[model samples]
Target: MAHHPITHGRAGLNRRTILATGLLGTMAGFTHRPAAASETPPFRYEVTRSDTEWKARLTPAEYRILREGGTELPASSPLWQEDRDGTYCCRGCDLLIYSAAWKVSVPKGWAFFRHSERDAVLTGIDGPVPSYGMSPDDDTTMIEAHCRRCGSHLGHVLLVEGSVLHCINGTSLRFTPA
Candidate 1:
């Protein structure tokens, strides 16, 4: 029996190779347009802007965590200590997503909210992000929250006591006085 480089025992596509190819193609579908001021990519969100505009609007730190999906150090957000009456809006699109009244302090070092405005936030099945606190098992997945208007990466929603806990990053939010 001779084995070819492209195939294994049966000389056909292997499960691993097919799965890998499918995974790569699926991941590629999530790619956004290039980072430039011109050439606005079509987005479902009402608010759309060029990468350059986003960069100019956001600070370097905010750009990384919000646009690039980078995580901030735990307990490093000034909003961590925020205990005022206000609304929490998306730093990317100024969309009012969370209410200050729903803020809950947890030891996890991120802003925890019990709820958000009905239409202000959207959710999706989070992809494989190492630090996203999702179990590797497909049965136990993580839910990601975002600004419905701008598609900004807010954070993940974890289930606690059978209730939803929106664990949002402080860098992804801005507070406004009520």
Candidate 2:
């Protein structure tokens, strides 16, 4: 009697078992791992406010985007159509974040700027938490911009057309004519 290579001497370990084990092992390797505690110290901004105070000070839309990291509807903000000499300040803490000089016309319907005032915004990687079972190698991460002084959620920093764009939420800003 000739024995098949895959069915070795009736040992009961067959190709299906080997393949299923390999598949499960590979899946286990990709299972989500809880994030370790952050090693870096948390940032302390120049301005801080209580949640109640922030909600009281900001409009519902402003609070949603500035405090909750939510996004405004595209083209909904009149600031997207604003073309004037002015500065844009954080609505949360009145901190200067962008300049009209840096503003650019982009079809994205959000307030787009070529850059921001020096040190006016801090950027960090924002994305879905890995604990949500997202793949570690996923490219869903985005560069989130925040108010340097108040640490409010501003928008995102993106590379557009070989230029660094500070794509900001107009609802999160208060425009001041320069």
> Model 2 off-target regions past 4 Å?
1-42, 128-137
What TM-score would every model get versus the actual structure? 0.67, 0.70
Q: Once model 2 is optimally superposed onto the true structure by TM-score, how far is the C-alpha of residue 84 displaced, in angstroms? A: 0.6
lDDT (0 to 1) per candidate: 0.80, 0.82
TM-score of 1: 0.67
Q: Tens digits of per-residue lDDT for model 2 on 1-178? A: 2344443533345336757677656555754754323323466899999999998998898889999999999998999889999999989888888889989999888999988889888887788633444676446777899998998999998887888888889998999887
Which candidate number maximizes TM-score?
A: 2
Q: Which ten residues in a row have the lowest lDDT in candidate 2?
A: 1-10
Clashing pairs in 1: none
Error of 1 at 82 (Å): 1.3
